[model samples]
Target: MTLDGHCAAEFAGVQAAFEAEFAAGNEVGASLCVMVGDDVVVDLWGGVADEATRRPWVRDTVATTYSVTKTMTALAILVLADRGRLDVDQPVARYWPEFGRAGKDEVTIAQVLDHTSGVSGWQQPMTVDDLYRQPDAAAALADQVPWWTPGDGSGYHALTFGTILAEVIARVTGTTLGAFLESEIAGPLGADYRVGMRGGLDRIAPMVPPPPAHVDLASLPADVEPRRTLGNPVFSAAITADPTFLAAELGAVNGQGNARSVARLQSIVTGRGRAGGRAFLSAETVDRIVETRTDGVDRVLGVPVRFGLGWALSSPAMPGVPDGDVCWWTGLGGAVVSCDLGRGITVAYVMNAMAPGLIGAPRPNRYLAAVYESL
Candidate 1:
């Protein structure tokens, strides 16, 4: 279980932790990256991408990292805001009038970015296929009344974050979120990340969900918030690998990239909106990331969370993250990306093997601990 890629001598401990993860069978195929200021201190990947085929995870190999895609979606919005084209303080309906319906006229772009917009999930049941159609997906969520009052508290908008953000982006830019992201964010920085699959189709690693895969959705009470938020549009790792799902612009969940690309793009926020010799956002815009728009127990996730713009604020719920003006987020399985503006550090971990829960899984946390230890 030899690890691939380079690790700075000082951060060799972090590399060892990554190898141990794969050696312990905790990671089928994964990539871990750490960036300091402008230098990449650590880059590593290993293990079988496809168990059935025995294909090794290589440089270009990417996986459908679930909600970590949210960071990219949110970054696109931040870029728009930095350009003075959009204001987080302004009502989203001002840009997309259709979004103002059902007591949502007061909901601002900041609220949506922070997941306190109250339209977390579509009250109407949605399948992965239905969400593929951009217009239909937007309409389903627009027509429904919010389950809670808008801006009351954070309810993790698991799937609808991208759908709602897409409408706003399209209305303002006259382009899809994926296209805008490619042109404005990923393209300028030359990062390999994508909102939807467009290139390197053969390099994607198939997701392997944790064993005993089926969750006990039936055990939870019918009215539980997690059940309501996650159950409405329930899906598994298998759905993420589907060709139709991959082709669609499901930005909240369907991003395809590896640890290298993730750290590169996110370093823009930690790097004061500049990366790869380009300035995609102004310092004022990057500062908005830690504005603390919402704080308290998350309705959907059933845990304490603090959201600032589009990233989660450092809090007790998220252990292993350093204390400072930092923000982070995770994908559905075990994928994670943390941007520490105070420390000028960005850490990202992307894996094909799906862990059971969403936030702060142990494997990535151990790697995080080792990274901080080295620092």
Candidate 2:
């Protein structure tokens, strides 16, 4: 494999670990980027973008960033909050009046951001096709009742988090999530990332779907958390291959970008609210991102987690990571962007190759381990 891009001498270990993933058949096409303060210490990409076409993963190649899209959505809301447009502490009814229905009148935007609003997934009669229709998805979420009490605890709102937040932004600004991101975040930061595909995308990589689930959903006890969380509508990576799915605004997912774009945008958190030479958030807002909202076994992931406003706090489940104060989130298939506020470093790993589970990806962990070791 011909790895392309450069790494500062101190970050040589990071580059080697990235190449090791490809050598071990763990990564087909991937990119890793690390930025300290304003300096980009490492940027590297390699391998085949599309297995069938034998396309190389070029300098500009981007791939689906599954859940990492949530960070962008969350950042947009934070920007709005900073500009005095919306308040995270206000009830949802303050903006989108209809969202107050179905026993959710008291649910605050902060609760929703922290995954504690309890409208985890759609009500019954859901299908993959429904996910492609933004209007229908938004309406269904507005009318649905919470599976748990508002502001009580968290049940990861795997899909609904985006729709709810997007609706709030739309109700406030009359702008779609993709449009706000372009006008405010991506455009300002010179980051090439998008919440949904528009027009044709060039140099994009196709993803390798994750390995099959460990236990058949049908065979699991009906009351189990994972079964309850993932059984409805069922998620398939194959849906991502559809053009319509790519174009539609899913918000929580369907984001497309690479390691460079993610780090460029998220470096704001590490940079104390500035990236690309502009202030996108206040230092106070950046500090709020680590305020603990929930620390318990995640209903959807079935692992211990510490969720903050829009990201996860470093926890024991994700070992080898530095400091509990660091905040991060991941796309499915091992792609992750982690910002260490104390270290003044932001690291991102993006790829077409997917590891089995969403979290604790061995390859990403190894890359991060190498990064801190270099320091």
Candidate 3:
């Protein structure tokens, strides 16, 4: 387990915790990056990027970051709001008229951001391939009824989150979510991240799918929240390796980047919507990012979660994160990122090997715990 990159002396425990994962065989290839203010205090990568080829996980390696992509999607929308091009409080249907159909006309963009839109998953039966076709998929969602009462509570949207927000973004900006992110966010910041895979195939670290989920959708009742949200198209983590899936802009799930790139983008929130002297979000928008939208047991995830605008507020699920005004999210497998506005700390971790469950794994827990302890 030869760890690479740099870690500040004050954060040596974080480095040790990362090395211990590989030593314990809990990691394949991974990268962990920590940023304080504008400075990167810790950056590290090691292990095999591809198990089949025995390729090393280099400094520039990027992998499919699952739900971590949500943070980026959220930021893009916040940018629009910051610049007065979009309003989070306005109904999503205000931008996309068709989205108003089927009782969703009242669904606010803030509700969509907070996972309380009640359009948690597609009502129509869809194949995984349907996820790749953005326009058709977005329209399908626009025409459906909410799974639950909008804004009553949150049911993790899972995949539909991207579709819903992307449609709104497209309606407002006349650009795809990927294009808006690239031109307005990633391109300007020089962050090596994208919603879809294009170019740099050689640098990708293929993810190893985790064990199959224990939920027996077949046994569950048809209208159950988990079955409805997770079973429609069903999730297959192997999509990270599929070129066609990688090429499509599935803003909720298919974000491709390493820890460093994820931190670079998410840190804007930690900086109160400004980074590198650029104002990506206004102070008011940043406040919205941490404002508690829902704080209770999530209908789909089946756990107590505190959701803010587009990310989760601090919760016990992420034990490594310190208490304060913080917003964060995790990817399938083990990828996790947390932005602490009060402490001026942002930590991101990405990996090839996956642990069980949709969110939170032992690997990131260990590293993040070490990070705060060292601090």
Best by TM-score: 3
Give lDDT tens digits, candidate 3, residues 1-375.
778899999999999998888898889999999999989999999999999899999999999998999989999998998788988899998998999999999999999899999999988899888988888999999889998899999999899899889988988999999999999999988899999877888888888988876767778898998888888887566667778877889889999999999999999999998887787888888988888889999999888889999999888877776667999999988899999999999999999999888766888878878888987
lDDT of 1: 0.86
Per-prediction backbone clash count:
0, 0, 0
Candidate lDDT scores, in order, read 0.86, 0.85, 0.89
The residue pairs in collision within model 1 are none
Could you give me the TM-score of model 3 versus the true structure?
0.98
Comparison by TM-score, 2 against 3, better one: 3
TM-score of each: 0.97, 0.97, 0.98
Arrange candidates by TM-score, descending.
3, 1, 2
lDDT of 2 at 227: 64
Candidate RMSDs in Å, in order, are 1.4, 1.4, 1.0
lDDT of 2 at 184: 91
- Candidate 3 stretches with Cα past 4 Å from truth are none
